[model samples]
Target chain A: MAKIRGSIVVDVERCKGCEVCMVTCPTGTIAMAKEVNHKGYFYAFPANPDLCIGCANCAMVCPDGVITVYKTKI
Target chain B: MTEATGIKEIIKPENLVYKRTKIMTDNVLSYCPGCGHGTAHRILAEIIEEEGIQSQTIGISPVGCSVLLYNFLDIDWQEAAHGRAPALATAIKRLLPDKFVFTYQGDGDLAAIGTAETIHACNRGENILIIFINNGIYGMTGGQMAPTTLVGMKSSTSPYGRDVKLMGNPLKMTEIVATLPGTYYVTRQSVHTAANVKKTKKAMRKAIQYQKLNKGTCFIEIVSNCPSNWKMTPVESNKWMEANMFPFYPLGDLKVPAEETTK
Candidate 1:
């Protein structure tokens, strides 16, 4: 079994909201959170952890290099 | 007994066949052997290296064989959805403003599925560089019908030979896209032969340089060849492109700014 750690979080300050990472994730785990950050920038949030196939697409498409998904194989 | 090694006999530290820093990632390229994409990739890298733009450059990887460009481009790259490289380029260039943004796209990826994105990107006057590889067939997807596939060429999707009545004529994208008011520089080049490859590298460098100047959309369309999919050896594919696609697409710069234009 594989365990995912350090959830994929989008830094609102850095994210341009291109939505490219959302489209590339194969697992459909990430979503644009309804709540906006203090800067009013809508950040992409990981909605479902179990669905994440850990493709690293979010990391790849984040132009600002803001998203990071930490995983652990137990 | 070891004889005195001459300069010719010296092993010379097993001269690296491939440079580690040149590759985008250590992951082996998934392209077929003798693929022209390799040539295009090398030339782009050389330009980035020569101009010292690797740090300031942002590349949009397309959805064809070059889709995995992040594996070899050795710079910041974004993998765009199928046919969306141009759109991604537009967005990145608009947002970053300072970075050198370019999109690498194949024939089917650019001329077919992404035609709208490609055309609109140029029409909108986006200050971005577009490297369009028109190999006349979809090399990555098992040689399917591509927008630029020669009239008589046969592919997996058109195994009966491309019939004009059914498949439509091959698209002259460079000529079509050159007409866009936003496109400041448009050239159709090739990498079929050494001479052609050199010319292509020059055109590619020019396009990238145009982007650095904040020039409007500059498009360099390489009328490349897919030997593996064309069912011909590398030599034969070169001959075929020269014979068939060259007259159709032609090789030359279509538009240059008036000041930069030679009198």
Candidate 2:
């Protein structure tokens, strides 16, 4: 079956790592990176990229403009 | 894909589901982690950019935690004295009636020092929009008790928790503004959740649309969170706000012009 593929790019340094994105993502595609960024805060990254639906819910809820989402049909 | 090739493919607009609005500057937000002000600012910028009104908007910045709004939004902005954003916005809107004029203010700035200015501007029916960020305490001044601070809410000034008899009660400024004849639309909203964000954005757009129609004043109060001052983690602060603030402030439109009101 054809599916919708989505990807998200996180600006590691720009993220304050508040985890709003992790909570807002519908598909549980985001997770906090184990390693810290230059600012010494754990940043969010797409952990299960294949599950992303590109709803942009994380970007909408993000206090800082850290997450950008892209979508394509597969 | 190679870096350059991938960049070229990504640049194709069709794949873009979401991108940061250009209305916001590249300057990193100075707000504390989990503060709702940044989310509010992004929503405002997104609406302005989507409406293509970037060139026709003028924002008035107040003296508070949101004072740096001018630095974040890449629009012509005027920094007003503490609580004087409405006065400045009034003048700007009068002179440039064609432009979309609005003020971004904090609870301390709008409901306290600028109370009179806020009341009179709405009373006089100024054709402008007012975005009020009510976090219940003075976030910029180390979380002092604000006019909107909930009863029993502890702050720097009310260390023992707000005593209603001693400190008075939290002001419902949005309700007060709705009573004025000059206000065309008045609503209380928040950015705590995706559904709430959508509502807040809709309120913002409606306020701006009414301003274009030369309708009377539009007031939108956003019940936000101040995690740093609240002494809670970002997640905990949101939870605290939902549990505490919403009961005292509540959400939804208090008033709307007859034209917008449905039978």
Winner by DockQ: 2
Measured with C-alpha atoms, the lDDT of residue B68 in candidate 1 is 83
Residue pairs whose backbone atoms clash in candidate 2: none
DockQ of each: 0.01, 0.59
Isolated chain A TM-score, each model: 0.75, 0.95
Which regions of candidate 2 deviate over 4 angstroms?
B1-12
- Candidate 1: tens digits of C-alpha lDDT, residues A1-74: 63432235455655444454566577788877787766565667777755654455565434334554544332
Q: Estimate each model's TM-score.
A: 0.71, 0.95
lDDT per residue (tens digit) for residues B31-128 in model 2: 98888999999999999998889999999999999888999999999999999999999999999999999999999999999999999999999999
Q: For residues A1-74, write the lDDT of model 2, one tens digit per residue.
A: 86676778899999999998898888999999999998888999988876887788899889998888887765
For model 2 chain B, the run of ten residues with the poorest summed lDDT: B3-12
C-alpha lDDT score of every prediction, in listed order:
0.73, 0.91
Kindly list the interface RMSD, in angstroms, of each predicted candidate in the order they appear: 18.9, 2.7
Worst 10 residues of 1 chain B by lDDT: B11-20
DockQ of 1: 0.01
